[model samples]
Target: MLTQTVFRSEDLPVADRFDAWCEIMGRVYAPMKMTSEFAADFRAHLRCIPLGEVTVYPTTFQQTTFRRTPRLIRQSDPEAYHLSVLLDGEGGTAWDGHEAAYRPLDLHIVSTSLPHETWSGRLPATIVGVEIPRAALPLPCGRADRAIGRQMSGREGVGALLTQFLTHVAADVGSYRPDDAPRLGTVLTDLVAALFAHNLAAEPLLPPEAHRRTLLLRIQRFIHHSLTEGDLTPSRVAAAMHLSRSYLHRLFQQEGITVAGYIRRLRLEAARRDLADPAQHCIPIHAIAARWGYPRAADFTRAFRATYGMPPIEYRRDGVRRQPC
Candidate 1:
């Protein structure tokens, strides 16, 4: 699952938010020469979710400046690439002898190991992205480095799909389970590869297995989104993808699970979350089970007990008992 941490300027004394933000940002991302007004009124909010090898950071803040100087690069080389998806306001960055302006939905790549200068104007700003490790991407260093500090249109084709996925993950990653982490990580990496290959017009250079895995990932995503629908069966999934039932079944072979088993397990996992959530104390276990597609309370209880010892009601009771005063 994606571990989450949130920091708000309001949490600390007005005089301390600036320095706090500077320190936190340095640790969450690579070290940068930071320059910003440390006024008492400055406001900032950061939310981080580390999903396996990929780390997602969503930030909104007041005017700020950041520089990745050669000295900082030599001091601590992270060797990671950041894909920044600007959600609001404006920003600009200069690197590798190039400078680019960015707006909402604009995607840009920043190399942590390389020197660059970036800044947000006096206006507030919001941005999100995945911090990808060097080994996660298939492209060689020299080839991938060409995209450093460059801007790409993130509103169409694979770019559009990639941005949508990032947005979803940012909003709902908390619902993910630990077992889902590695699978989601693979999907993130594949999407990054597809987006880069498309941008470089190097689709042919991508590994054959990666191309196939990407297709399966896309199919699984569709299934996940439609799981709540009563018709989220194999036939519906295949029809939605314009694929034959056999072909769709074959796709899940790579994951070592049948399509039906995958869907059932996901639903069960979701039901377990509701059972353990103190916030859902008022909701009945049967209702929660029905909500996740287990319409029959007896069957739901039976399956819940089989997967996790004890019944749903006991699980919820235990959750209540664990709450701190």
Candidate 2:
């Protein structure tokens, strides 16, 4: 039930696209002076999804320069952090006498309380930005400021998870209800807090709930990435994450499942998907099982049969029969 706003420059008169974009930017984010060579016929698109106190804007726009001057800051400042994950093109931001160049998959944060200038390269930049109010983030200003304008990798660790979560939420806006917005906002805020703490080496600053949630997310991501490896197990996962095996089990216990059960369930789910896909029909059953962490064919057959109540071959055959000609 969540609502979203879509903007396409082509919907307006060619001569007015740039001005309209500027107006939209002011309303969506903050007041800023934006200039672009393509202003005459600026081509751009934006989708805005509001999540309680936070908002997500996924946009693709032609090269543009944006400046937030002290005068503008004085006039109005929402005191929010505009965190942008650059998906395409090149760009950089200049703030507080510091400049950082960024490419795709780089996270850039700018504080609305401070004046800054942002510019894109010749190519149109596709960015998924999360605008989070300063009050929503639990970290102190000084701690958060240390990360602003600095290049943070959105390709790995908590940064990567946050980036993925934002992009997924933006892409799948219709999958959620209005009542889910606040909850989504809470999750987003926690991830941002966790990322900031991780970067600052100040995990203790986060509330206990935030810390536990972040660690669980990290563990889940690690398991998904390593699902194909043969050494993926409770002991290996615990060792790699530097946690005791018992603690790992206890963590999964909260979910009403064991660590081993979680791993097996994930593997089975992956295998089931592949088995039901007609395109993968030619892939041997044993080969498909091995690809999903079950190296031994017998072990995979036994597990898959117990979970799905049918042998892999029978499942695939049944799936194929149900497909339309």
What lDDT score belongs to each candidate, Candidate 1 first? 0.78, 0.86
| Model 2 deviation from the true structure expressed as Cα RMSD, one decimal place | 15.7
Instruction: Name the top lDDT candidate.
Output: 2
> lDDT by residue for model 1 over 1-325, one digit each (tens)?
5778999999997678888888888888888878764344468998987777888888899878789899999999878888878898767777777666666897878888888877765468888867898888988877787766545767998878888888888888768886777677788778887878777773334345544644665575566567678668889888998999998898798779999888887788778877766667889888888888888999888988888888988888888888886
> Model 1 compared with the native: what TM-score?
0.60
Per-residue alpha-carbon lDDT of candidate 2 for residues 1-325, written as tens digits (9 for 90 to 100): 5789999999998779999999999988899999975676689999989999999999999978899999999999998989989999877777777666677898888988889988877579999988899989999988887778655779999999999999999888879999999999999999998888888784224345444644665576568668889889999999999999998888889869988898898889889978987778999999999999998999999999999999999999999999989
- TM-score, prediction 2: 0.62
Model 1 residue 33 CA deviation (Å) reads 1.0
